[model samples]
Target: MTRMLERAPNLAILYPRALVKRGGGHELPDTRLGLRDVAVERERLTEYHRVCGFGPSDTLPGTYPQVLAFPLAIALMSERAFPFPLPGIVHIGNTITQRRPIAATERLTFEVRTGNLRPHRRGRQFDVVTEARVGDEPVWDSTATYLRRGAGTGAAAPEPGEVLPTTAVWRVPGNVGRRYARASGDRNPIHLHPLTAKLFGFPRAIAHGMWMKARCLAAIEGRLPEAWTAEVRFAKPLLLPSTVDFGVRGRDFSVASGGRPHLTGRAVPAPGNATPHPG
Candidate 1:
């Protein structure tokens, strides 16, 4: 928690350096990242909402703040002292909470810090904690959990989630990952190209878990409050150019293919939350 880095990070530059960062990525230290004066461009925001299947509106999408804070999270995770490499790390789950509605007109401040490494059956895991604020008011926060397979104590893996009946079928093209990467700045190779994915043991390019979460939120967007929390667990990889079953029961939802679960989660109203933001 000592060294604090502040900059308007360029994804194009940072992404390449992250791939070959120093320190073997075995040290778990708390590092702070700050990006002040963050503003939302309406045009870009609209495209993001469209790509994620959410209807465009003046109010920010529930999951968009996390998308805003992701580059800062990447800066922390790619540090030499981090416990795992950026490449091949699996995004197992994500939990996001917003205390109040976030309007499109407000300027934002983003802070990201990474710590809390612990053992998992598959290997090791850690959380990248992020928060977004408008001056002193907290708008959103998230705990994105990732697992580094084969880096832990070999304990029993966690049990699976409930499997619901297929509600809808989706044809996810191979380029969807690349599309999302362009919008979200998550140019992780495993999700973009089949050849790069094979290097990491995936048979084909895979979908971004966050994209799945966003699409899930879009499916039930009108129902969610401006301020709410969503907890999503990524059960398996959604292969690109694939068809998947999407099931949503009230606030609980799931995406699966061939009986294999890909993403599962629930959305709940935040404390004192009532009305949705108006356009």
Candidate 2:
């Protein structure tokens, strides 16, 4: 079953629901959530571009649709029928596929669902799938993998590979998370002030993974094709107010701080203009 809506549900309203709804089931909710005719406000879009270091353009950034679709993703995860608690779940990886450049003026329809639950070395993992469309044609889609830590499979952690050569160094400000939160509406406590992050076991505030992805895309914006895919696996937490090294090799890119990688990702042109999944 799918529940369709004409407007986006408020994040302010959904966050509380996520806090109160406890999850422990083995099966995921069978229903999918959809929102139609979602408008794109230019002012908000520009702010997002500025915060993520993207230069001005008529088309939307590849990661922008995820921000537009995020509220519904939260709504789906906040359901009592969901199988994992929202509070402690971790976003481990994400892959975004863009069929073509979406104009900032285009009205979008979004749909979200979850599946592919399986065991992980640290605990369990699952996918939160979201897609965006202009009318009936799919324009963009993403799969965000999340982990819920608990009993492990006892597998050895994967070893780190050779660090890529640095091309540039960036000084990330302490308030980057707040800026991105305002732009993207993802105000996870760990990404906020140091005091709030301490409650989550972090010594200081951390960067948002999606923001890291968007920044990486901005770094290689000139090289991206009209239609493409970008994927990233997040590793260490990037502490706030740090200077980090950025590197790129062909279509691949990485970010590191204190000689440790915080993220690794790549972007490549989509093959043959194939239609993207509608989710």
The prediction achieving the highest TM-score against the true structure is 2
* Candidate 1: tens digits of C-alpha lDDT, residues 1-279: 434345557777777888776545565776688888677777778878878998867778878888787888887777677766676578898999988877787777888887777889878888888888777767788999888777568665555466678888988888999988877777888888999989879999999999999999999888887668999899978889899999988889889988888988989998734443342
List the global CA lDDT of all models: 0.81, 0.86
- Candidate 1: stretches off by over 4 Å: 1-6, 22-26, 154-157, 272-279
Cα displacement (angstroms), candidate 1, residue 273, comes to 6.4
- For model 1, give the 10-residue run with minimal summed lDDT: 270-279
Give per-residue lDDT, candidate 1, residue 54.
82
Give TM per candidate: 0.91, 0.93
What C-alpha lDDT, on a 0 to 100 scale, does residue 36 get in candidate 1? 82
Flag clash pairs in model 2.
Answer: none
Residue range with the least summed lDDT across 10 consecutive positions in model 2? 270-279
